[model samples]
Target: MRFLPRIVTFFLLLPSYAWTQTMHNKRYNVLLICVDDLMPELGCYGNSIVKSPYIDSLAARSAVFTKHYVTVPTCGASRYSLLRSTLPRTKAALGNEAAKILSDPETAIGNEPETFIEQYRRNGYHTVGIGKISHSPDGYRYPYAGPKSDQRELPRSWDEVSFNPGKWGHGWNAFFAYADGESRITMQGEVPPYEAADVPDEGYPDGLTAALAVDKLKMLARQEKPFFMGVGFFKPHLPFNAPQQYWDLYDAGHLPLTAVPNIPANINLASLHNSAEFNQYRLGEESAALDQPLSDGYARKLIHGYYACISYVDAQVGKVLQALEETGLADRTVVVLWSDHGWHLGDYRVWGKHTLFDRALRSVLMIKTPAMSRCKVVNRITSTIDIGPTLLELCDLPPLSQADGRSLIPLLNDVQDKAWADVAYSYYNHGISMVTPQFRLTRYFRKEQPVIELYDHATDPLETRNIAERSPDIIRQLTPLWERGNTGVYAK
Candidate 1:
């Protein structure tokens, strides 16, 4: 090598390393907010009916992702994919039992694939998980009808994982709880799927969770080390229970039902299912059928309940954001709000998220970092799994070598980037969906009555028409992209 001055040689040899060091020294705090079963029904997503003012405000300060998706449509698998920064590597990762399956020491990759939160904790950041930061709603193990287990969902990730079930006592109980400490478990099938109780925010479990998170923020603010605080909110998911005030924000009669409530034309009806998840509440007025539309009155009521829960969760998020500002941590923190997966409100005649439909796969994702000032919408395709690598890169951490997602920092820096991935992938059991910029292609790995459905997003944004039979060239173009998503159990 040619001889040069010490300073000049050092700069020439380590420009990228020096930048990473400087960024690492900044010690930016990370606020990861995970909302459960939230659809893109916010005011920012151009739905004027939903009263999501706080999240909308956050969107104004953040790079809003209009085409973001998850790797799985169901909650546990979707969250598992997001946290692990990988595609579902096994069949168990595709179910609600993902915590037990993916975190088990015997079968998990390297005795549980290292979580991004665990990486943050290892990097000397104090990691805190408030509610359902993992597969479980309260970050603890629980049977569907029993008390909670002593086992933590991600045993080695958090410096502190705390939740206040209040009078509901445990996680699953609080999951279907209402105001005044009453949960569905104690109500004996008498309680309805939705409730608008006349009480304060603390009347519901999410309200209590918000209060706990605020207190945690205050505690984290006093700490000397940078923190990775994951605040998970359980709302708008099921049993759409909120304080009556949030319900008062909406007019039931004015709220519109889904325009495309029937099965898509020429698509397999097997792709859609009855609203079994919604009907499980035991007191629902009517069970959603694959053949029949929900009653107009019941549909309005469901919409009202859904919006109420969204507003309620929005208020809780507002409190946390307010705390961030008050603690003087806003400037030093990177705030990201994401939903596990999207839910359906009578779309394709489905009331819950189970299908490989775009309504279930596409979700809400927004990231606000200290480096970005002007808010923009990133229309480029992205996935929730990309979140892990993005956070790692932003914090100057080492790359996750096994991660399936690419860092979205490029899009964050320039929202109009054209060289981004043109497709997003989502999976449900045996079915796989690939969402390209202008189309959605789904394939079910079935030996009997195999299904390959395609929807052209250019003209049918609602995915009401399956054009696979009419468009052979498009199918040929997108088939490779669809097959590339066949990881885990679906892989050949």
Candidate 2:
């Protein structure tokens, strides 16, 4: 009887042992790198001027997404959508506190949506985050001055949420601080829109963020379990601050200006603003206006500063990637680099991201999986929210139950698949825009007047003219897409 019991125990243990071994052998790690306000302007994306050698080199071994669009133009709202794999459910979801608000048990509904990072942490992975992964850069709740509270922004998402604010005392300060540690709030609109300090990368917060991520990568290398590490860089977003070396790389004379700087014809003044965000920096050479254009010299200077910031962020990315190689974890890691949303250099006489145009919604997205080949580009219309589900699929994890995004695995596996969604959607305030291969249709529920805007991408890629008056048939066809994207909200 004793021998029979021993035999049965051994048989039962065999399956469990084999399952453990399989899980151990096939566990793939993830490194998610997020950049703020980055568009597809790297050399890899055919922008010959931007000096982004590191990101371009990484793109050579990754799947570059050419037409990836975010659900919203602002950073916090877009990041929230990416993390939850869902669209914004309320107007609060479009603000800087979107994550903190949506994840609260008091405010959230239906058992609360699970962030992909939380999902990984639950499934035996060592999940970590540093710098601006959420609305709060430090991953904690803090005020402007110092001493962040222990309360987490995403409560249960990270095993380790760490950041080094460097010269500035805390995350929010560093977010708006310059190379010399002078913060924007302190300056109170006294500073210029761009700066090129004669200092090393450490003079900015991103360099410190890179160093900390590299250290964490080293620590995670010794552990036997897998890791999902997120590193978010804040640069090229505001202040356009970069090391002087990066700024020196670009010549102001040769930098290109926006081909379309005027507002579109037959458009309501409500459709565009006077670039209030850019003008808020008091030291700017000129205040943006709808009735006038910025001086050519001043415009070139701003573009030059934007390019320098891109290079600065690119250098920090290179350092973190190098650490992965040094730790001998490169082959086992899935690398994903993306931006929160796009920014307008001079498009439509606007200088910020609070618009429904492609200039504000189209962002840079690239991924390099362990099984992916080198230098592949996918030109399909994809959303930023699709990333969470794609990572889950690649890691062989179960699908997220509350996810509103579809996996991009099909497109990654074969770029020519025809079953993908042709339209990409974006929303801000009371308006929603649906972008298809042929047209971008937008509608606004304004109390003053009913507005409809349509632009044919094939002919008016710059959106310089709205053809809604002549394109009635196109509007009827695209209205359903716009309605479906709105999800029954803001349709009045």
How good is model 2 by TM-score?
0.92
Best-matching candidate per TM-score? 1
Local error of candidate 1 at 211, Å? 0.8
What's model 2's lDDT at 271?
71
lDDT of 1: 0.82
- What overall lDDT goes with each candidate model? 0.82, 0.82
Model 1, residue 423: distance off in Å is 1.1
In model 1, which regions exceed 4 Å deviation? 1-24, 111-113, 447-450
lDDT of 1 at 474: 87
